[model samples]
Target: MIDIDATLVNVHSEKEGAAPTFKRGYGFHPLTAWIDHGRAGGGQCAAIMLRAGNAGANTAADHQQIIGQALDQVGLGAPRPRSGP
Candidate 1:
C-alpha cells in the first residue's frame, strides 16, 4: 500500500505551486483492503478519498488533472472525474 501523504508530496513537487492553488486546497488518503482472488487467495485493493474545493471551472479542471497525474504515478491510472456535487 502507498501512503497518501507521500504520494501528495510527489505530486506537489512535480507541479509549480500547483498544490496550494487547489480551489479549497486538498487532502487525500488511500485505504487498502484485501480481496480474495479465488484460488490465489487475496490481493490488494485501494479506495482513495480526494477532497477539493468547488472552485470555478478552470481551477477545478486543472486540479483534477493534477490529481489524475498523481494517481497515474502510483499505478492507479486516472480517476473517473465527476461533475460538481
Candidate 2:
C-alpha cells in the first residue's frame, strides 16, 4: 500500500518554488509517498515532488503523476491491473 501527503518546509531564504503557505510563512510544500511494510517496519519513501507552498493539495493531476512515480520507484509499473478479491 502507498501513503501520500504533503508537508510545508520552512525556509529562511528565497528559493525556487518557495511561496507563502497557509501558516503565513514562506517555504516550499513537498508531496511525499511512502510504501507500507506493516510488521516488517515502516517502509521507505517511494516518491517526492517539491512544489510552491501556494500549490493546492487536492490537485488531481499532481496526484496522478506522483502516484505513477511512486509505483515506478517500488518496482511496479504505472497503470497496473487491479487484483480481484
Candidate 3:
C-alpha cells in the first residue's frame, strides 16, 4: 500500500453543472500493488472516488506506472519502514 497526497494533482468534478474542486472529500487513493523480483503484480485494486467526470485525470496504466516509479525512487522498492514513526 502506498499513501498519496491528493492535493498535489488536479482532479475533475462528477456532479453535473458543478465546478471542479481540489483536495476535498476523500483525499487519498489506496493502491494495493507489489513490485516483485523486477515485476509488478497484485490482485487488490481501487481508485479514488471523485465527484464526477474525474476518471480521465488518472487512468489505470498511467497511474500504476507513476506510482511504481515514485516508489522506486523513494527506496520503497526494497524493504523498509512504510510509514513514519
Q: Which candidate tops TM-score? A: 2
How much is 23 displaced in model 1, in angstroms? Answer: 18
Higher-scoring candidate on TM-score, 1 or 3: 1
Q: How far is candidate 3 from the true structure (C-alpha RMSD, Å)?
A: 11.1
Question: Against the correct fold, how does model 1 do in TM-score?
Answer: 0.28
Q: TM-score for every candidate vs. truth?
A: 0.28, 0.82, 0.27
User: Candidate 2, residues 1-85: lDDT per residue as tens digits?
Assistant: 8888999998999998799998899998889888885787778899999999988888777787788889898778747654345
- Tens-digit lDDT string for candidate 3 (12-58): 53434334334444222332333332324332222343223223345
Count clashing residue pairs in model 2.
Answer: 0
Candidate 2 runs further than 4 Å off: 37-41, 78-85
Q: All candidates' lDDT scores?
A: 0.40, 0.85, 0.41
Q: Best by lDDT, which number?
A: 2
Give the poorly placed runs of model 3, Cα more than 4 Å off: 1-55, 78-85
Clashing pairs in 3: 13-52, 14-51, 14-52
Question: Please, what are the lDDT tens digits per residue for candidate 1 over residues 1-85?
Answer: 3322213322443333333423344433222222333565554433333432222333444445555554565577845768788
Per model, state how many residue pairs clash.
0, 0, 3
Q: After superposition, how far is residue 46 of candidate 2 from its true place, in Å?
A: 0.4
Off by over 4 Å in 1: 1-58, 78-81
